[model samples]
Target: MKLMTKLSMTTLVASCGLASAAVADVKVGLIFSLSGPGAVLGEEMRNGVELAYEQLGGKLGGVDAELIYEDDQRKPDIGKQAAEKLVRSEKVDFVIGPSFSNVMMAVHRPVVRAKTILISPNPAPAPLAGEDCNPYYFAVPYQNDQPAEAAGTYMNDHGIKKVYLLAPNYQAGRDVMEGFKRTYKGEVLGEVYTSLEQTDFSAELTAMKAASPEAVFAFYPGGLGIQFVKQYDQSGAKLSTPLYTVYTLFNGAANEAVGDAGLGVYASTPWTYNLDNPANTQFVAAYQEKYGTLPSAFAAMAYDSLRLIDGSIAAAGSADDLKAVRNAMTSAPFQSVRGDFEFNTNNHPIESMYLGQVEKDENGQYVLSNQATIVEHMPDAYAGECKM
Candidate 1:
């Protein structure tokens, strides 16, 4: 592993040497929830970045890129601490993600104050794209609400009327619920916010059942999603109302844990293993070969984030010049596992979203299926509000 890493770093440095026509070392920092409830999501992201780094031979945009990875433990305070150390001490040229929204919010000020560019692979809480929109921050993935927006549209199209809403008590959870209601135009029987890492969802489920809504909409990611799906199924709710979700029950290790509980469930996303794009197919095959499992949406986003940064550095010819790098990244057009994507004015993606169904394959293994493109080059709510 050490030899592979050294070789990759050398290749990256060599590429950067060629691009700059001079030698330069570029530092990049990654902050993610590598432990706690969100560890699996962070691990997927870390794997994606690692794979990209290895494939690039340690060079991004023809520059020697040095990555410093730190775990946030899915806590806001810890993420802030990591951000401070990475920026003020280690002096990373660019930053990527805190995975969870609360952590991102905590890390944002220090990163922006340091004038370093933040390339968020996840954490699309509404504020960062709205009043807090910063010139240095960019998200390769769609905002947190985009998937929920698609779910709302699906419900609208299906003529569903009343629904109960459930999400964690946090910024991202609220963002998704609001986004869902924005498009559905249906009656929300009730809304419930559970503790951030709490495992028990029975009380919330009981309330949801009491409302007797036509459908149940939720936004639970990582381990919470797995627990919710299992409990929802065990509660016998599946026998009655359908569960409509955004990034809740889908593919990857999460789906594997969900098992038959997630079967027939519907969720919305911008990418899936079943997507018919050439890029997606290649990514899936390569990832499966390397890791012995298909890549998750988080993994795909991380891969794109690295490639995007590489493209930006290549375009600007210097990762050391963060302002130039940021500008290049903002305008860079790059290929992703999800196919073509470009940043909107808010530094968030204007990309496609799909409604996917969870089902078992012939092996009786759970997988994502029926990926239907619901929106393309979709605009976020904050688009009209952003001046840049």
Candidate 2:
């Protein structure tokens, strides 16, 4: 009689487990530069998240997934507030991003303390990859410096010397300039730091022109980039000195706004819309149809982040089991739009970086076209320094 009772209890437990598995919802938290100077990037990222959710039919691994999004406004303090809301109030299973490196740093501590998974769609700053490396943190995009390092090497090979350096007065922008200086053995005529929120670059451009550098390397992203490129063209400096970039030219709205002024400018990136891969082709087509515009690398990164999280949830077999889910995410081998990508020791992406030029596509739309594949299997600087 006792043995019979034990068998009945085991059967009841199994039935309950099955029922629970059938009705669980996966929650993902998304944060980005949703307003101010970096709003365009955030818009692209938000659109990508929406498109991915749409494509997934509101489900991941046969379970309904809910996405909770917040705007960081490119402010660290605001990012921390958003992270708190997502982790505690919303109780999301995973957090997606805070686009800018400064914002990422501000929010990383809180998320790590909560033992929640934070997948960075951007912000591969070096220190986070090394000394501050956390088990719960992962980056979907390549490091902030990798593309810039590749660009530096390309500039050196092209015989560009006496270059002018321009970047926002912030950590990420400074890191880009440092990466470029590490590789390019050129004479830097001047290194200028502008307010990250400032859209006007007239005085800086005038100063750079007076310095008479052979080329200009600018690290402005989003709207600041569009403004800089437009003003540069109007200054007629584009007619002589070559303008080199890292992240400024590839954003969707920025490209359209800058238009012909952006043509002939060179930039480096880890991924572009013109890559000749089946995955990228399908993604581009679907994205354009859904959003009515070309997708930026930021958008692609966000889409890939969702897919990565989804792959982990599927592998874990249950979203409720946090340990199992985290383990699955750590070892995930999900497909990305950028083709092959594997996590480095520091949880950053190990991938290819390309030096691309801005030009008009066959459809007469300005895009990151004529991408010249630069470094393949390029590693980030911080991974080697990390003991983990």
Best by lDDT: 1
lDDT of 1 by residue, 255-304 (tens): 89888899888888888787778877878888889898878888888988
Candidate 2 residue 335 C-alpha distance from true site, Å: 1.1
The local distance difference test score of each candidate is 0.82, 0.82
| Residue pairs with backbone overlap in model 1 | 8-58, 12-58, 12-59, 13-64, 15-62, 16-62, 16-63
Model 2 lDDT vs. the true structure? 0.82
What are the per-residue Cα lDDT tens digits for candidate 2 across 262-358? Answer: 9999888888888878878988999999778888888888888888887887898977787787778777556788885788888888888887788
